[model samples]
Target chain A: MTELYQKQRAMRAMRKAAMQRGVIAVLDVGTTKISCLILRFDGVNLNDEGEGVGSISGHSGFSVIGSATTASRGVGFGEVLSMRESERAIRTALQSAQKLANIRVDHVIACFSGGKPRSYGLAGETTVQNQVVAEQDIARVLSACDVPDYGDGREVLHAQPVNFALDDRSGLADPRGQLGERISTDVHMLTVDEKVIRDLAHCVKRCDLELAGVASSSYASAVSSLVEDEQELGAACIDIGGGSTGVSVFLKKHMIYCDSVRLGGEHITRDVSMGLQVPIASAERIKTINGGLLATGMDDRDMIEVLGETGDWEHDRRLVSRTELIGIMRPRVEEILEEVRSHLDAAGFEHLPSQQIVLTGGSSLIPGLDGLASRILGQQVRLGRPLRIHRLPQAYSGPTCSSIVGLSLFAAHPQDEWWDFEMQSDGYPTRSLKRAVRWFKENW
Target chain B: MSQINPDRYTRSDPAPSLWSYRLLRLMLSPYLRRMVFYGIPALFLVGVGVINITNEQRREQVLTTYSEMKTFVTERPEFTVNLMSLKGASDSVMQDIREVVPIDFPISKFDLDLDQMRQIILGLGPVKDVDVRVRSSGVLQVDVVERLPAFLWRRDDGLEVLDATGIYVRTVTSRLQYSNLPLIAGEGADTQVAQAKQIFVAAKPLKERLRGLVFIGERRWDVVLDKGQRLMLPEEDPVLALERVIAMDQAEDLLTRSVKAVDFRLQNRPTLQLRSGAMEAFREIKLMQLGQIK
Candidate 1:
């Protein structure tokens, strides 16, 4: 645990250094595509204290200088399957983006939607040594949380303090300098397979980039796709990616739970290919053009030609009705949404005040996905596009680029994680001189 | 279906090779890009130049070419001096100046050293100051201020004309050539030309009788008259002494009384040394007055 804390701290420090450099690249290594967006931080904070949504949703601090996307290779379920191929794919996207920006980016904040994330909610309480709560008291309360055994070969990706409670009163956002006898906090910790992180880091390192920070694509997409009120009132963002569908639950502007399903739009494409006896590429094209969750009578007449390069003229000229194509795609998409529904239910998402579900990512572009999602997830289901950022091209303004856009926002403004705070001195191996001085000051 | 088939055939691998990716990144780096696009070429050109110039023959060739180019610009007709115009000097003094400042016509002004040439011209006796410049009309104008000969000093070698400040101007062959100029003779007399001229002014009443003033011991002046009589004046106020001598001579006709010389070297005393005949006549007058040798 301490090793992971040190590693996360190092990454946080690197992120701060990248922010200091004023140029950072946000790479979303998705199953279907690798998208890179180079953000140039102008060091301007548009949203000051209490300035609500100051400029472009508080994104005036950075501008998207360059953006590029390339078809992913050797990546499945948002995990790097082949190191060499993924490295090359990353290189391709980053090189093109750097070419567009006319600058070199060294630090990258990457996100992936694989690794089978598990969320844990921890509660800890401690008696405040002073009448008013201090930063140390908060740290002590946070350190008092009992970390659960997330099992071997899994690493804690994010551990964020979600709520602070003072004595009988609860849900205090901050308890510092408040009259409280006892301070307690609720922390949300998400863990993923360690091998996935190592592989992604290796790929990024192979591309000559420093991995400044790594985030789950589900959390990143939630950051961009969920509206401010939706995040505050509690909402769930379902990112239907190529190889995975990422589900993240946000409440009070914080992500409490996130998980990803192995099934995604790529499964639908594969289903289409097998059902129509066509090539994977043609099936992808057919699914994009004709794919719908709710089939109509008119869809039965609309035929999509499935092309093949098998050197047989008859085989290359095959046609499939849109309804038939939808018949092939809808079940896989439904399976993915059903898998997300189970994860949301397990997270107790139905208990939240607002069960608003936002459907985003590349697969969310299918027509009639929201109508079908509203039936399965909840009535508040809606298709979400990423928030508008400065200098983003029109082509990247679709639901497909949500994770990458969200990763840019994550790079600009990262949430405070467990490693961001000073660890309680009791967790230290050696006696602290500061603790000794504090003891003398309090007692003397 | 047709569109998908074409894309399958034309779908090139978009991933760059590892080496190509690294090279592209290196090229995108601002420092390395500037080095490749601007620095390397500049350094290459400078290195080639340095290598070429390192050879002795090439170095000599380059130097010669540079100097030839320089002369090509300097030798233009507008910059060339075709003639020298002498001004504010007499013919003889101008001839002396031309002799001292030897230069060939049609030479470039850049090749001429005016200051050195001015110094050489100033070495001539009559030139007090000189200004040398090359005019725009291809003329080297030399303006000379010649010293005026104020007195003729008769030295052991010959008589030389001296200016008012006692600087030698020229040599004179005969005294009559500058008869209006007073003659001064003796060692170091040229240094006292100013005082001698002042004494001459003081002795203006006896100008017809005065022959010249001689610098006796480099300290005092002796006024010589045509009758072989001399007035030895004191050094401190020689002009005043001479003035007093002239006043006495005017009142008593003392200079025509057969006196050989008047001595006024001391301010409190005046003396006269008479000629032999004048002394014998003075004694016979005394004997007639005393009835001793009638």
Candidate 2:
């Protein structure tokens, strides 16, 4: 069927709306923080090949007009822990962000951290009704795929036909009029717990905002941060948040797979808290200020002051070496990376051309995190910062803000997805959402 | 000194039936007549085909082979030389590549030699055509054509060159030649090369003056600076970029001279860059490009 069409149109409409309205908002709902950003869309910057839009005012079309973040409550492991508190957090972040942008938003595409995300490279084939594989025929073959019922209480987050094979030609992006007896499709589908998605959707609803769409935080982070080459060949994005670490894999510029580890910066904080006998907040401060994976001979002599709960302990806390902190924290950080590596392996990440890795999130700021990650993840690793857009606030431009900035860019221009689709059902079918989107406009 | 004799026209009279007459003429032209009149090679070809391939089954066999040849490209896999990696030229990057590719190659199975594959796939992400050869001294040699970069991706790590295929063939240590290359930024860049390639390949008209491209959301692309001026284009199609480029040149004097940058990530309008103030100075000099900003 023509499923790819609706997705394409929805994405086109969202992008068009952002361009026309000139302002867009991105909302990131994580287990630790609810961040919001308002961006002003600029011009249609055209490249020589006439792909991708250009900048606004001769600058990148996106700029952070306003930003606001609230401490996330009633959240654990990246999913809503309690509906009421999550709603309050959502309202608080949005209200402040709207005040800064000086506008109101009726719809919000929320990015969450929960869900046991799984990926499948499904394929389908059909002998073309005639020798030529028309779009309809492609759709038919895609629909013909015996896509298993992903089970109950689950939603298909992303269903995309990544590659197409027409007759003897493999890897064909579009095979509409190609003469072929058999056409095959490689579709990547990602699904998550229905209850988690439903809760997030309900939370948005409770906030009186329409759920335009939903994306995995790691997936969105990967979109805003990864470079073209990294994405094409293959790359993994590790988003270490307060309560969870999100992992997303990209190949062919699409998030072929996504998953989240129920551990993140929170674990580090806990390790510091239990080790040093400090409050959660104080542990966070120390972790950020004196964090390192490698502590050498020089560290033992480096003393740090640990403030305590006894209101009058001023200097009573003994100084601890940086090496001591690393000794405590390394195991946790290493655990997270190992978990991510397993996730990537399960996604078949090794098959891609390039195996570069990007590390993002607020907690990735530890001094030697990139080095540690590269050593552990078995790839070229670098800490990721959000791509520069117009009017981005200097305060929010670091790796700490990759998710919110990414979410904003995502809202203004949502990706091609399944809901934005139209099933041709002309006894014809397509698996890719973009084609399904396009199929709707022209056929549906 | 060479002359044609009138005796060459000796076969003008008829044979018997149309088939027998034609057969006799064919037979006589080379063997019976042309042997005494014209040549032998042409006669041999016609006799072989007429005698051997005239049957329906034989004719079908020949047609089938031709059709098969059209599809499979059955020439020996042509030892395609990729030339993407080099042995010692920038060993760090070369070493980095080893992390992603298998250290011990399956050369035997692919009918490729390690030395040959090393030369073929090395330094070749952007290269279009490449050839591998053995030197007289037994050194493996390679000839390559690298992919032309349409944009300069300025990332958190460093600047790298990406071709239409979005392969980061080499890092751009020098921006002197391509100071205004389009840029592709963001995370997961290696995975999005296909998207970048689509955009790069689509930016054909602006190729001569293209500086670099920037990738924002891994889903779409943004045109960074072009001709030193800024132009904004949409993610859908750079038709707006094309129109703005045309409009600026036709009306606003866009790219008429030097440009600052262009924004085309929007829907309708394009922001023309004019170096009028500190803000632009702030915008133009990225921290990564600070070293080269003389």
**How does candidate 2 fare on TM-score?**
0.53
| CA lDDT, candidate 1, residue A278 | 78
Which CAPRI category fits model 1? acceptable
> lDDT (0-100) at residue A380 of candidate 1?
95
DockQ of each: 0.32, 0.00
Question: Per-residue alpha-carbon lDDT of model 1 for A1-444, expressed as tens digits?
Answer: 679879998987787777777889999999999999999999645345223322211233799999899998989998989988888898899989998998889999999999999899999999998889877898899889999988999999889888999999998776678898988999999999999999999999998999999999999999999999999999999999999999999999889999999999899999988998877887888888878979999998998877777767788787778898888888887888889999988999999999999999989989999888888888998999999988999988898999989988888877767876666766454557678888999999
i-RMS for every candidate: 3.1, 51.0
The lDDT values for all models are 0.88, 0.68
Deviation of model 2 at B3, angstroms: 99
TM-score of chain B of each: 0.84, 0.35
Give Cα distance to truth, residue B81, candidate 1, Å. Answer: 20
- Fraction of true inter-chain Cα contacts (below 8 Å) kept per model? 0.73, 0.00
